[model samples]
Target: MTREEIYSEVVQILADSFELDAASIKLDSTLYEDLDLDSIDAVDIFVQLRDLTGRRPDPEVAKQIRTVDELVTFVENEIAAAERGDPEPQPQMPPGAGT
Candidate 1:
């Protein structure tokens, strides 16, 4: 999907997950500070993105993500890379599977 489409979906996911107004989530909005999202919320966002994009973003890369725009861009790149077979499938345990 295009970046704009990915961004729109990301906004919807955030709004639905947090019950925040979609208008309140700007591209530059900091997920933690502006959105009041804790670490667990971040994980939930990642999980939702995984479901939406069918790709798992690297946790290391995710640590550097600070804004909604960044997340959208990351997903855009991930989806494109996955389509091109640039990303090897990584093992994933379902949430709480290891704990």
Candidate 2:
């Protein structure tokens, strides 16, 4: 998806998930200050992003993700890196478990 498409989807997710105003969620809107997103809200956004993009962004990435544009970039990078097998897989296992 294009960056604009991702941004729009993210904005819609924020509005639908958090009851935020569609007009208020801008590309450069500060999540904490502008949207007043608290801890739980941030978690909700992460979950939604996970469901939508099939990737869980790191909390550090979330901390640095101050705006919608940054979030779009983050998701894009995560998807790309996942395709390239760069980031470590979740749920570290001891060799083969179901063998």
Candidate 3:
């Protein structure tokens, strides 16, 4: 998907999941500060993004994502990478998995 399409999907996810005002979300809007999203909200967004892109983002890189533009770019890159047959980094196992 194109960047603009990814951006629109992100906006829709925020609005639908968090009851945010779609118009209030901007490319430069910081997810934590401007959107009032806490850590749980960030996780929720990651889940939605995973569903949308069929690839989970690297957690370390995800931590550095701060703005709507950054998220859109990430999703766009993930889609492109998938199209190129690039192997995605696997999500780490949770603590105590297979214990």
By lDDT, the better pick of 1 and 2 is 1
- Taking every candidate in turn, the Cα RMSD to the unseen true structure, in Å, is 4.6, 2.3, 3.9
Q: Which residues of candidate 1, in runs, are more than 4 Å off?
A: 92-99
Enumerate residue pairs that collide in model 2.
none
- Which has the greatest lDDT? 3
Please give each candidate's TM-score.
0.86, 0.81, 0.87
For candidate 3, the lDDT comes to 0.88
lDDT for 40 (candidate 3): 94
lDDT of 1: 0.87
The residue-by-residue lDDT of candidate 2 on 37-71, one tens digit each, is 88788778888887656765677767777777787
Query: Which of 2 and 3 is the better model by lDDT?
Result: 3
Backbone clash count, each prediction separately: 0, 0, 0
Query: Residue 63 in model 3: shift from native, Å?
Result: 0.7
Those runs of model 2 whose alpha carbons end farther than 4 Å from true positions after fitting are: 92-99
Expressed as tens digits, the lDDT of each residue in 1-99 for candidate 3 is 767888999999999998899999999999999999999999889988987778867788888899999999888888887778888786579877765
Checking candidate 3 for backbone clashes, the offending pairs are none
TM-score of candidate 2 versus the correct structure, residues matched by position: 0.81
